[model samples]
Target chain A: GAGVSQSPSNKVTEKGKDVELRCDPISGHTALYWYRQSLGQGLEFLIYFQGNSAPDKSGLPSDRFSAERTGGSVSTLTIQRTQQEDSAVYLCASSRRQGEQPQHFGDGTRLSIL
Target chain B: AQTVTQSQPEMSVQEAETVTLSCTYDTSENNYYLFWYKQPPSRQMILVIRQEAYKQQNATENRFSVNFQKAAKSFSLKISDSQLGDTAMYFCAFMKHAHNDYKLSFGAGTTVTVRA
Candidate 1:
């Protein structure tokens, strides 16, 4: 992909339902990250995957939020039993490596929990 | 943990003029990286400029530039010859230089609107 790609650009579901967002990082990018942007707020880091290493899950807000990257490329973020507060934009970014490399981002998926 | 702050919530600029957005961060780490990102209504995060803590000189990219002060913990972005396309939300971000620390801490963002 020329840039990071996210699917289902918009999602609307009822509370208590589970939702999954997908991300396809730029080709050859070894580092992938997921973030959440609430209404009128800055992006909050959720998870980071660097190559084959165990993902850095320190930023996950709660147990309901989980993410996994398969084959070190495509990543999926799943929210279990979504709450009204879960309504926000889920963003995905990828960098050539990690460290000082600037991450490229996708347009993001806007999740609305009604 | 690092924290970035953008005191201004909104700003207005005239096209062809220049505008500056303020940002400050709190960090104890000496080695780190700072960045300015622009997100328009389209919601794509675009990197405008980046400054390394180790570099005393600021970073500039065409019409976008940053005034990075290490001691003051401030990284302000300046847009020269602003264009209508520059009307967007600007974010300030900080990242640690450590190999294991790749996540970025971002500010609340400042919304900039350009007037014709």
Candidate 2:
């Protein structure tokens, strides 16, 4: 696509329900990243994927939060048993290669756990 | 662990005026990158400007420029001739230059409002 694309721009899910967020990175980009932005807070890194390498999941807040990138192009972030505290905006970004390159971001999915 | 800090939670400026947003980061790595991102009500984060740690000259993009003090670990953004379109939440971010490190550590963000 022309830029990074994210699905379900807004989601309102009940507590304990699972939600899936999708991201389609820019065409030919080799790096993808997931971040979470809470109300009035900074963006927290969730995960990173580079090419075919093993994803860096150290930033995931909990085991309930998981992400997977398929074919190094599209990615999905799954939240299991979502809690009210999980209400926030999930952002996805992609860079040309990785190092020294600026990341392009998608509009983001605003997940509201009610 | 690297950390970015933006002390100002909110700032206001009149249209066509200038405003400076403060940012400071703590990083042990010698080579890294600093960035400023703008998020409007639309929820999209747009990159405003960035500075390479090794460069002595600051980065600039038209009305947006940065004052990067590597020694002080400070990277402040200066918006000249602020427009209503510039009213947004501005974030400061830090990233190491290592080949395997690509995650961006962001500050709490500063909300800028340009009034008429």
Candidate 3:
């Protein structure tokens, strides 16, 4: 793809319902990351996947939040039994490599938990 | 743990003028990276500029430049010839330079309103 792509640009769901947000990173990119942006807050790091290495999941807020990246390309973030506080924008980003390369971000999926 | 701070919650700048957004970060690591990202109403975070901690010279991109003070742990962005399109939420971010550390610590963004 030309740039990072996220699916379901907007989602509205009832509390306790599970929601999945998807991200397709740029072609040949070796690293992917997930972040959450709440209203009036900064970007919160969620998880990261680099090549074939073990993903860093230390930033996941709770056990209900989980993510997976398949074949180091497409990634999915799942929230189980979502709460009202989970209503925010979920963003995904990718870089050519890890360290010094600037990350390119997706438009993000705005999840509204009603 | 690294932290980035943008004390100013909001700022207004007249079009064609210059405005500087302040940022400060706390990190024990000697080598790291600092970045400024712009998010418009569309919610896409676009990289505006970046500075490498090891470089003594600041980074610049056209009308966007940075004042990086390593000793003071400050990295501020200066937008020259501001345009209406520059009105957006600007974020300052910090990341370690280690190959295994890629997480970006971001600050509470500064809302920049470039008015005509």
Q: Which ranges in model 1 have alpha carbons more than 4 Å from their true place?
A: none
**What TM-score does the predicted chain A of each candidate obtain versus native chain A?**
0.98, 0.98, 0.97
lDDT of 3 by residue, A1-114 (tens): 799999999999999999999999999998999999999999999999998999999999999999999988999999999999999999999998876468999999999999
Query: Each candidate's TM vs. the true structure?
Result: 0.99, 0.98, 0.98
Window of ten residues with lowest summed lDDT in model 2 chain A: A95-104
Q: Which ten residues in a row have the lowest lDDT in candidate 2 chain B?
A: B95-104
Candidate 1's error at B21, in angstroms? 0.3
Taking every candidate in turn, the Cα RMSD to the unseen true structure, in Å, is 0.7, 0.9, 0.8
Top of the candidates by DockQ: 3
lDDT of 3 at A12: 99
How do the residues A1-114 of candidate 2 rate in per-residue lDDT, one tens digit apiece? 899999999999999999999999999999999999999999999999999999999899999999999988999999999999999999999998876467999999999998
Tens digits of per-residue lDDT for model 3, B61-88: 9999999999999999999999999999
lDDT (10s digit) by residue, model 2, range B45-82 = 99999999999999999999999999999999999999
Give the C-alpha interface root-mean-square deviation per candidate: 0.6, 0.7, 0.6
Q: How are the candidates ranked when ordered by TM-score, highest leading?
A: 1, 3, 2
- The TM-score obtained for chain B by all candidates, in the order given, is 0.98, 0.99, 0.98
DockQ for all candidate structures vs. native: 0.91, 0.90, 0.92
Which segments of candidate 3 are over 4 A away from where they belong? Answer: none
